[model samples]
Target: MKMNKNYCFIYSLFFFVVSMFFFLFGISIGFKSMIYILEWELINLNSSSVCFSMLLDFKSMIFMSFVLFISCMIIFYSNLYMNLDYNKNRFIILVVLFVFSMMFLIISPNLMSILLGWDGLGLTSYCLVIYYQNSKSYSAGMLTILMNRVGDVCMLMSIAWMLNFGSWNYLFFYYNENLSLELNMIVFLVLLSAMTKSAQIPFSSWLPAAMAAPTPVSALVHSSTLVTAGVYLLIRFSNLIFMAEMNNYLLMIGCLTMFMAGIGANFEFDLKKIIALSTLSQLGFMMSTIGLGFPDLAFFHLLTHALFKALLFMCAGVFIHNLNNLQDIRGMGCLVNQMPFISICFNFSNLALCGMPFLAGFYSKDLILELSLMMYMNKFIFILFFMSVGLTVMYTFRLIYYTMSMDFNYNSYFILNDEELQFIIPMFFMVLMSIFGGSFLGWMMIDIPELIIMSSWSKYFVLMIMLIGGWIGFELSNLNLLMNSLYLTNKKLVFFIGNMWFMPYLSTYMMNYYFLIVGNKIFKSADSGWLEEMGSQGMKKIFDVMFKKNQNFQDVEFFIYLVSFFMWIMILFFLIIFKM
Candidate 1:
């Protein structure tokens, strides 16, 4: 348990330096004109031989740049975040390994390399999640490992299927050319894997449980590295899914997950859990964009989300670290006057998260909503999208209000130390980015057609809905009785819908008929008198005869061995006679 400060500091510094190098390299590559420049051969290695390949063009460079930028921020944040922890050395090592894995994932040219990097990330993250080794943290880490392993299995099967029918090269290979029933199965399995890893729907419960880890781990895992892997997979395979025509199903699942997680966020009191659920909801939005065949939108949202969510979680860390580790929003209030700097930064990030105009989230989320509206052509999907957006604003502001509005019991003279400042500096930069990064990117010369088109009607309609929903949520917060009433109503509806329209009686009926009644009978039959006893007795007798024999048993064993030898000789004699 001895901490190694020197090792932690050195490795952290090394990771931060290397990550900046990659970021600069990616930016240079992204802006270069490959069409005008002469082609230079890049070396690529494989099992058979080393082959020459061309360097990455614009698209690959963009993703790589984003990955590097996020990796750098995460490493820099971890330097201060892990300083006081007992296992600082281990934390620094895992953080560097995580960055390396993500770098490999981004630069991978083939599915095999991507998967190799993907598994590396999963393994390192699992270890980091349980770094505390408390019972709750360990259990949460185990659940994450198990659920993600299921995703890994699905991915492996998909790879096998692809290799069997298609080529090993994931890029440039047209999946539609070899589309078949089997290929469709593989596609479904791959999508399932993406959903599980992304923490969508039924697989989402594990993410909230993962809040048992330190706040920084939650920030990194939820925002940048672990959950986003699914989004990366979908982005990489957008062409294949489009070719297979599975967008409709994907869209449905994404919409459902987004709304459900949004609603769940409304009811959460735990600050970290709320952020975790928000991460799930935002990822669902990204998946929906991918489902709608807009990988660019997904990528844009992913970038904006990482910035704001990381800031928010780090701000939460500041609050927790200041208040002696209190996580419940209800327990602490009116924090803005006390922690003015952290409050301002947290509010700026939350504004971006709430998708307020001119913030990082506005440009990306607006683009997604516009694309979803255009592609699905379903009013219901649009309605759900708006509702989720509304819920996002509601819960986010609720978090703000609960944290900064009620009361400030602590002395107003509390100050942040240098270690805290290390965490805060990155957050301040993120706040600035959340305020301006989207607009800057919007002005950049990228082919985002969705942003180019201006529809007055669509704009008015979306703005009106968002305004109304925001007002409703704001007003509801003032009326205690009405708020409780609405909570009860939503509870009933959610329970009914979640139970497949059958209320409490449905659960009772299923349990009585399927579990209690039928299960009991099956268990009774399985443990019945004659067959059960005979089986148990037979196993015991076999072991006894083999290991616990007396003189009589030894004689019998010798006779059996002599008989086996005689039989072997007789068989050999018969074979020789036949041959003669």
Candidate 2:
């Protein structure tokens, strides 16, 4: 069979779709089994050790279904999105590999397989990000790769520690082993990895930089696969984290990342970059839930975020494509009159992203906030959560207002066509899902009607804060004084954060002046000195003298035997010492 390049791309897509189908089918079957088991009131955890070991229960099935479903949708979305690119085949291959890696991560039965998939997913995302090979994309890809490797190393070390000193079993055996100090250190390292992978503080600049990739790749990675891997790991190893009782550190990191990213998003003008920062903020919420021992809430919010964030990215892609890759919100205006369908769907997704009442974002986000209050009872974390929610609405509507509400002299040259409509349709379905999916899931998950009503208090308060923040952001965006002052203040704040409070600059100067400059000059001069040069020249001379002349003789057996005897003596000496 002759292999065609285009056929390869097609096959890649078909293979991914089939893989996704089986994954989702497995989840559905698991769900059915759960229902039957629940109905008959049976406990079957011990019947199948493999299933229990793998965590393939109702909770895992629910999350796996959401992940696979979104993976399939994004694959479909990418098909249309990548049509104009020249390297469509390569893109498809990486996309398929990315999805396959994520599925493997979710279904893996042990830490080793999970880490294998985790690293694969990270490497594939790095390739996809730099696929364009431009300076910005290349730089962003390199930074992302570097930061994720730091996290990967932490995870690998933790796993190794567990295997050596703690647990070698597929299940968490260390928790029962009474190794408190070792287990706590491992949990801390894993949490550090989670923070880095999820783009928490100090490692978050890479994610905003990653906006240079194609929108679909950014959407798929930041929304569903790569970034979420950290949270999934935390949830998977909840027992270890809880055992270490490191919730305070988790809560603090989550709250700080949320506020920092939220403030950063408010300053962003690039359409996709705004969404990217919003993802960071949303991820903080998920992490905060995990910190509160509410992995279920975190998983719920993850599903809601995947739907709306994907929709937002796809919609932004359509606008950029129609406008010949123009990305600034200032370059667009009154799109509602031109692309009414897209405008409506974008608004719906944005609202859901903003956590408007009864929407997908509302249910999961409310649950997270409620759980946060219950777990921490700290005003600072709660306030940060509220402020993040408000800022989320602020930036989200800023996107809507600038793109759809303002007046602009749009050229008829930039218009959506049938090909673009294909991309929009998937987003339309996502908007529907973002509005109704959460409510349906909420009904299924929670049985108390009053609990739902109680959850509404948090929802209503968040909505109110969102409304206020939107109004303030809209007003300030239009005013010269407030905008200029806010910009100045933001620059100062970013400067402080970027410099790590000037300690980095101090350390750099110290290393350069005291170590690098003096050490390098001294070392160079010493190397060039007569004694060193003589040593190098003498070594080369010795080598030449020893090997330059060769004599061929059949009577060289004695020399060979002498050399073998010396080698054996050295080997025996080293072996004796090594054994001792």
Candidate 3:
């Protein structure tokens, strides 16, 4: 026990010091793009298996600095957050390793070297997500690891494909216009890996469920580092990845994810889950921007979003920690009067997330929307984009109104206060940066791409969406513009909208229900229906759990929405763009 304690503390500090060095080093590099790659050819090693190296450009440096800075703060916050735990040392060790793994991923350009980091991120996140050692955490962990394994398999397939291309280093292949079928497949595999890592649509359930982990871990892993890995990877690979077919697919999936997550967030009762869905929405926004041929804009948003989103998580942590782990937002209200400092943090982050001009998220998000309008695609896609943005504001306003605007709704016996120094210190820095991170990065990263405005209608799109969404949020959440019967009559529709368009059902059950059925029968045959040997007990439990989760899945389905949407989207798109 003593050794575990010392080992984690010493190493965390060591990493903290190293992080400061790299952060300063990164800042000193100061928007000056640098290339550092290392290669070693060993005669004893197979030719194709030789080690390839790292790529440290301006983006990597800035991103690394932000990641390490946030990580260091999270580690400090965890000291107080996890002080009561007996396994604090183990937890800290996992976090440091997670940080190290992200750093490796950021620095490496070689597919082989990057895998070391990518796989490490998957495994460490699995460890972190399941750290509570309870049934809930265990289930979340299984989902997290399984979804990640899909990515790992895709990466392995990519590496195998790249082998025929003569090198393990894939950085060189991004712009090869003349390519074989196998090389094109490599792009698909890479896209799959990014989507899975980032928890984009159809693989997104694990993220919201992963709130089963501790809050500090949530702040680090979910908001800033782990999920962002895919976006970073895509940015690295974007030159070759924006295929017309693939980009269209990405646009659809990403917009759908953004739309679904926004609706989910608005309906989300749990505070943490709402934030988790918001993160999901942001991930979709980034991916869609990449599809829109603005990977640099995507990266810019990625960095800015990280600054405030991490702050948002930390603020939520303060409240959750104080409310004794109470997470339902209905159980919380009018917090601004009580935890004034935290309310500021929460509000700033939320506003920033809404891209409410001048904050970290605004610089990128506004640019993203403007770019979306400029594109010559099916107008419904553009509508989906704006509608998603509006939904983002809607949910954000809903969350704020519920938690900050009304009188306190928590149990009278439960107490809330701003008492923890560790929590306060981390948030103070994060809040200040959230106010300015976007503007700073926007200047540092690139000149804001000149937006091609389509018309007067396009010019006012952002303002219109935000105002309408914000107005609807306050009205719907508080004033009750409509009666309960509307919802009661359309209960299935409401249910589907609220459940993130039932993405969890689509991701988890539909993928495995069939396989689980077969496994159950096989288990019955192998163990004579005992269901105890050959890990049949585990499989049986998993089957039962999934079945119960899926039983209530059909109030509405995405398929229903999809079929109907095809019929109306064209009409709606024209109306939207021409200001009808």
Candidate 4:
């Protein structure tokens, strides 16, 4: 126990110190508007060099710094959160590996080199997801890895296609102003890869299932690093996408993802899953922003979202910890009365998520919304943009109501206290960051002022939607808890929408069920049945019969042959004499 505590503290301090240095360096790099590429020649091929390269600039440095910082906090929180677990040291080690892999992904500019970090994240996260070694965790881990592997394969294809350019240094190609059909294909593949990683549209089911991992792992994977890796990759390739005229597709995908996740979260009752869905919604928001030709705004929102989301997950962990590991929101009520400080932090984070004024989310989210309105979008995209926004607030308020407003619903004997300094301290620090991280990042990331032209109606649209959504959420929360057991109202509808439009089922079961059945039938009829007899069994039986006949013939041969030989000799002598 003491050893685990010491490991956590040491790793946390090491990451904190390193993060500060990287953050400071990133700031300086941003001020100068400079990029430094470090390259090492691994081998020289015909007319090309396979080099390991790292790109150090404002974007990579700043993102890595935040990743390390969040990792530090999560590890510190884990020391107490995972105290009862036997393999705490192994957990810490896996987390450290995950962080470094993210850093490697952040720094690499070469496509070939990027794969090392890319696969590292997928592999490390799979291990972390299955750390508990239970059936549920194993299922989640398999889904997570298999979904990510789709992205991995797409990236490998992209790398192979990039070979036409005679180099794996993607940054060089990106800046060379080359807009060929090949580049478009490459960008399209990259989009698919990013979509899978970021849990967009068809690939969205894995994000919620990933909540089966421990909360700290969720905080790390969902908030900043693993999921956002896709967003970051697209941000780098935004120029190519725009040149290839693919932003429209990206925009549609993003809008649908945002709306789907927002609706799903409202239907969700599990504490961690709701947060996970919110992360998905925010990711959709970022992707849409990128699609709208404001990559910097997307990046700004990504950083800000990471802060608040990580803090939110940490707070949820504390609640679950004190509540004896119950994660269902219906089991919790009036938790604000017992753990007031954590409740405040949790609520504030949710509000920040809802884009409350002056909080971290508001700084970036408001601008994105306003910019979205200013753009020449169709009526449906416009409606989806705001409806998704409203749903965001609606679900948030619903969550707050279920956990904070109602009377206590769970076991009365449970103790809900926030005295664990390790947990509280990390959440406290994240609270401060989630409050201010947005404005600081906005100022630092956005070098030029964005022009805005909107009427009065446009200005008030966001506020109106939020208010209406909050009201709806309040009304929904007032439902008869006694009559409706969380999921009993229109069971089929709730079940369909609540399960992410049945995506998990579609992705996991429906996609494979028929194929597996056919495969089973084929195995029975061919490999184990008719094919077995016709191929090997029939040949063996024929050989066995032939061998038996030969054995019988050999068995009679000795005595019968002697008698026949003598009779044939005497008959042959008489016949020969007659013939002669």
In order, what is each prediction's RMSD in angstroms?
Answer: 8.0, 10.6, 22.2, 6.2
- Cα lDDT of model 4 by residue, 28-114, tens digit: 988999999999999998978899999999999999899989999999999999999999999999999998888888899888888
- Judged by whole-model lDDT over C-alpha atoms, candidate 3 comes out at 0.82
Clashing pairs in 1: none
How do the residues 179-200 of candidate 2 rate in per-residue lDDT, one tens digit apiece?
7777787778888888788887
lDDT of 1 by residue, 262-380 (tens): 77776777888888878988988888788777887788788788888888898898888877777888777877767788888889888889888889999888777765555535788
Candidate 4: clashing pairs of residues: none
Candidate 4: worst-modelled 10 consecutive residues by lDDT: 480-489
Q: Which prediction has more favorable lDDT, 2 or 4?
A: 4
lDDT of 3 by residue, 70-157 (tens): 8877887787788789988889889988988998999888788789999999999999989999999998999889989999999999
Q: After superposition, how far is residue 145 of candidate 3 from its true place, in Å?
A: 0.8
Alpha-carbon error at 296 in model 3, in Å? 0.8
For every model shown, what is its TM-score relative to the native structure? 0.79, 0.79, 0.85, 0.89
RMSD of 1: 8.0
Better of 2 and 3 by lDDT: 3
In candidate 1, stretches whose alpha carbon ends up further than 4 angstroms from where it belongs are 1-13, 32-60, 409-419, 445-455, 485-580
Against the reference, the lDDT scores of all candidates come to 0.72, 0.73, 0.82, 0.90
When sorted by TM-score, best at the front, the candidate numbers are 4, 3, 1, 2
lDDT of 1: 0.72
Q: Tell how far residue 441 is off in model 4, in angstroms.
A: 1.4
Q: State which candidate has the highest lDDT.
A: 4
lDDT of 2 at 295: 82
